[model samples]
Target: MKNYWTISRKFEQNMNRLQKPKKETFKKRLQNYLIKFKTKSPQITEKYKYFLAGFIEGEGSFYVGLKKNSTSKYGLKVDPAFSVTQNKTGVVHLIAFMVLFQTGRIDFKSGSENTYVFKIENRQSLVEKVIPFYKSYVLPLTCSTKKQIFNNWVNVINKLDQGVHKTSEGLAYEILPLVFASRTKGKREKSLQDYQKLVLLGVRQ
Candidate 1:
């Protein structure tokens, strides 16, 4: 009877060992996961896109640059640009803005205080990519002031495409006035009244 009981106990122990799960190493678990996992590029979601647009409505600037260039037909060149400025605390939004557009460059500006700016300066990118993306996703929801400025800026760009900014008179009478007038109040010396004064004064070095 003692021998029979001992043999039964040994058999039960063997059965428990066989039923227990095996311990796996971290590397083995990761390897198993990789077998089923696939990697792809990161994508911008629609919700983030709308958030960026609203953010821009508050902090962005659409600028049209008119600078003296004697070699050009107008003796001035039109440099149309889009930019958003923010403090260091707002750097995340700036980064997201860059990612959404996937085209501009980030820069730091130092003045009375330091700030960061994400700027799009390339004409091709502005007209083809930046402008269209905003037109479709952002512009429709922009506020009145921003909408007015944006509309004027786009018109100037379109006119530039048609070669309207190629002559000195054209730049003085058409482009400069439109650009300066579109900016927020108190930005320039004054409004369209100072357009000629600004042009004749030449750009400050």
Candidate 2:
């Protein structure tokens, strides 16, 4: 069955490869490529899949770290502080967002103050998302450093609900940001590499 939600799932699988391989003999970082790129789930992808190919080909604005993507288009930043969980690849240069897709929360108006903790309703980023390149490839990748950043994300989200104003830009009926995907540089260079490998695999399949 063709799942309506083709976006995030592709991301998860892609992110898996970017994760530190359990066995030291692991090679081919393709899977990790796709998953890491999953963070930037823009509305265009949600409404239309035209960008899917280019996205897989590493043609958009995603990087590693807290810096903003040169290709950062609006609308992705739907919520005041909500970030999509682009977990597998690790830190991009920018830090626009990094939250998992969290839907079905108790109703509340925007601009209110409260701490919200939305559980992983659909997808979420894991360890590989935060592993550094040197650590990922050279040394034994661990989650100790990643956990701190992960904790920061949790803290931000929790704090948002705890009194931070969830304000929007005027009366615009922006769809509430239920999903969080972080934007960053590509896996290989400034784009995700795992995407192409998966596409090839998909073709082979």
TM-scores of all predicted structures: 0.68, 0.19
Candidate 2 on 138-199: residue-level lDDT in tens? 12332454334334444333443453323322111211111112332234332222322322
User: Candidates' lDDT values, in order?
Assistant: 0.71, 0.28
**Residue 112 displacement (Å), model 1:** 5.6
Error of 1 at 14 (Å): 81
* Candidate 2, superposed: residue stretches over 4 Å from native: 1-142, 167-205
Best candidate, TM-score-wise? 1
| lDDT, model 1 | 0.71
**In model 2, where is the ten-residue run with the lowest total lDDT?**
170-179
Error of 1 at 30 (Å): 30
